[model samples]
Target: MALSRDRMIEFLKRHDYDPNTLQSMETKEIQEAYQEVTKKLLGSYFHLTNDNKSIKTNSILLDMGELTEFKQKLKDCANDVITLIECLQEGYMKFDYSEVNDLLAIALKDMPMHKMQKISHIAYRSFQEILLSQIATALKGLPKEEFKVLEEFYEKRRNDTQFLHQTIDKLKDPATRQQILTMARVKLMVVKDFMPSNLYDVYRDYYNNVPQKLELVAKVRALTGLYSKEYLKEMPFEELETLYQDILKHNEQEEQDRKMFLKYSQAIQESVDNNDDEGFNEICYKAVTHLTQKQLSMLVEYMNGQNPFFLSKFESVVHEYKKKLHIKR
Candidate 1:
C-alpha cells in the first residue's frame, strides 16, 4: 500500500519530522527534497537553514510568541466555537491529523520554532521545556556586548501575542528564543529523522486518560462551529481507537456524528482526491471522538493504513463528489 505522501509529510512535521534526515540518507538530499515539496505544500514558510536545528522562521507577526494571540480569537468567537460544539455534541466525528499538519507546516514555515513547538498539546509541552531550558541556560552569565545582538532579536519579536500567552507573566525575549534555538541545533545537529515512537505512544496515553479534557475539546466544536484544525494533536491513531471505544461505551453516541463520520469516510475514500492529507487528518481526528482508545486507533489505522491508495473504483467515487464540488465552486 502506498503511504499517503502528504499525510506522511504532515506526520513528520507535527512530530517535528526532521525534514533534513531520513533513515539511511544524506541530510542535504533529504532536506532538499523536503524544501522542494514543502514549497508546494507549505508555501513560503520554507527557508534555507545554515545549521541543522533552529526549525522555521515566523514571518507573519515577527515574534515567536505572537501565536498565543490567535488563541484569543478562538475564545472570543464563542458563537463560532459553540456551533462547532453543537455539531460534535450530536455524534462522533472523524478527522485526519495530516491536514492540520500541512496547514500548520505551511502556516508556520515562517513562524517561530518556539511557538510552533508549542502548538500541539503533546508537542506544546515539549516545546516549552525544550525552548525554556535552552534559553534560560543560554542567557546565564552571557557577556553584555553580546546582549546588543540579543537586543536586536528581541526588538524583532517584542510584540508577539503568543509569547505573551505562554509567558503570561513575562514576555519571552526574542533573542533568548533565537539563541536557545541555535544552542539546541549545536547540541542536536546529528540526531534527526523519525521521532521515537514511544513519545507518540505516551502522547496517546495522556489523550486517552483525559476524559474531562476530551469532553471540553468536543465542546470547542459546539463553541466555535469548527472542528479542530490539526488531526489528532493529542495522540496517535492506536491511542484514539482505544479512547474512542471506551467513550462509546459510556453513553449513547449521537447519530449526527455517526452520519458526519460516515460521510467523511466516504469523502476521503482515497488519497488522490483528498489533496490535503491534513484535511483528511482533521476528519480522522474528529472521527476518534466517542470511541474507546482501541476502537479509535483501529478505525483510524484502517482508514489511513488499510484503504487502497488510488484504486480506479475509489477514483470513480471521487469523480462523483468532484463533479458536485465543481458545481458548487
Candidate 2:
C-alpha cells in the first residue's frame, strides 16, 4: 500500500534493489522490476475496479492526464483481442476459462496494486490481452457513443493496471471471487437491456469476451471438484447443465436426503468460517453428485440462474445457526 519514494527505495535496498544501477537498465527492465515488486506484494490474478466492488468484470481506469491517449490505446488493444477471441471461438467454446485466465495474466504485466486481481482461484494468464483485443473489435461494430460508454470503464481500469495488481492481493476468500462476478454483472447491467435472449451470442459478439467471468466459473468448478472428486474437472456448459439438471430430483427418503444435505451444509459452514470458498464449493459439488438426478437438477438450476436468492438464504442460514453449529472462530 505504501508507494512513497522513500519506502520504495527502502524496500528496494532491503531486497537489494539498486536504483542508480537500475537507471542504466532499459526502461523495459526497470518496468519489469517495478512490476515484480507489485506482483510480489499484490498478486497475478485480479483486476482494479473503480466502483469499489470486490470482484467484478468492470472497466480499466485512465488517469485524467492520459485519458485521450489511453482511449486510443484501449481501442487498439480491444481490436487485437476481440479478433483473437473470435478466432479462438471458431473451434471451441469461447468459455474456456483457463485459456482466458492465461490471456489476462499476460496483459497485466505492468499494472500496479493500488487495486489488484482479487481472484480466489488460480487465474491463467493472457485474459486481459484477449479482452483488450475484444474491445477494439466491438468498437467497430457499435455507434461511437455506445462504444464510448461501453469502453469507459475498460479504459479506466486498463490504465490503472498497476493498482489492479495490488488490489487483487488484499481480497479475503469468497469475497474475492464473488466480487469479480459482481463486477462483470455490473458491466452487463450497462448493456443487458440490449442483449438478446441468447446471452451467449451477445457474450460472443458485442461483449468484451474476456475471461473475467470465467474466473468465477473456474472457481466454482474448482470448488465443485474438491468435494465431488470426479465432477467439474473439465466440464463444459452442456455437460455441466446436464449434471446440474440431474441434481434437481429427490427420490430418496426425506431422512436419507436430509442427512446427506446436512453433511454438505456443515461442510459449507466449515469452509465459510475458515474463509475457504474453494473448500465449500467442493463439498457442495460432491454432495450434489450423490443426489438423485431430480434433486441435483433443482439445486443446480438455482445455483446457475438464481444465485442471489440462493446465496442470500444460504448466508442467512449460516448466520442464524453459527452458534448452534459452533462454526465461528
Tens digits of per-residue lDDT, candidate 2, 27-104, equal 565545654764543232233333435344455553545434433343345435454334333212222344333443
For each candidate in turn, the TM-score is 0.18, 0.17
Over all chains combined, what TM-score does candidate 2 have? 0.17
Q: Give per-residue lDDT, candidate 2, residue 323.
A: 54
For candidate 1, lDDT tens digit of each residue in 157-215? 43332341243223256654454444333222212233333433423433433565566
Best by lDDT: 2
Alpha carbon deviation, residue 127, candidate 2 (Å)? 16
Candidate RMSDs in order? 28.2, 26.9
